[model samples]
Target: EMALASDIGVMVTTDPSQAYAEPLHAWLFGEDQGRYLIAVPEGGVDPILRAAAGTGVPVRRIGTTGGAVITVNGQGAVSVAELKALHENWLPVYMA
Candidate 1:
């Protein structure tokens, strides 16, 4: 439904664990054949922000192809440098 209607799909869920799963499924269905983007809020423990820290249930392992870009934000502002560094260092390795 969403894939048929939009050129891109943005899934914002409170549960980070579920975020990637659906995207991956959509990709399998050919809905995300190089036409979709999945973004998630930083998953960490911040008492005031109601974020989760570390790992537990609802968290699952998934492999990235490395070219995918990830962005991190704090209080609605992106941490540009940090995200860049992360992409540079991690993205290639994951994709390779």
Candidate 2:
């Protein structure tokens, strides 16, 4: 819904750091009331960082969000779901 609800189109970025890695991935594939994209401008996170400093809040600006879904303008790239699914598969084993 992030895309459909937003007044304007959104863009998202990918961060290599563990802090934002998984979260970004989840956001990418989300649909029907989930985050789609965000255009985080350069130095946009500076203010938030300053506020969180010394408060034990760690923060890093990875990418300035902008552009189409495939072009999020992120720094650290995450493989797409199709490619990821091809690389691995899991099944649970139960013991009685």
Candidate 3:
């Protein structure tokens, strides 16, 4: 629920069934219509990526981004310097 509410939804779950539900719902309802799915190590292997990708949802392995750079459609890759800037600037505001 919290994930869906955020500007970016980051879901981490071991249960394949539970993992599939959110993305599937988003896919079906057009909730995250053009949103990109940035998957971490575990989430990188999620079936939802494939499903969402098939439906034109962009998905990418961006764990290395450290949840910094915001991407859409996974087409262009954000540079580490850009991510570092985001982290340095935003982390203090959000984390505090």
Query: Per-prediction RMSD in angstroms?
Result: 14.8, 10.7, 12.3
lDDT of 2 by residue, 3-96 (tens): 3333233335455444544465565575635333333446666776687585866555534323333235534343344333433443222321
Tens digits of per-residue lDDT for model 1 on 1-96? 322233222222233444445553353345533344333334432431332223332332222212222222112333334455565679787888
| Clashes by residue pair, model 2 | 1-33, 11-38, 39-65, 40-65
Better of 1 and 2 by lDDT: 2
Error of 3 at 38 (Å): 6.4
Candidate 3 RMSD to the correct structure: 12.3
- Order by lDDT, highest first: 3, 2, 1
Tens digits of per-residue lDDT, candidate 3, 1-96, equal: 222233342323233333454563454335454554443455556786688788986555423233423333443445445555565679688978
TM agreement with the true structure for every prediction? 0.19, 0.35, 0.24
Residue 40's lDDT within candidate 2 is 47
Least lDDT summed over 10 consecutive residues: which range in candidate 2?
A: 87-96
State the lDDT at 54 in candidate 2.
58
Which ten-residue region of model 3 has the weakest summed lDDT? 2-11
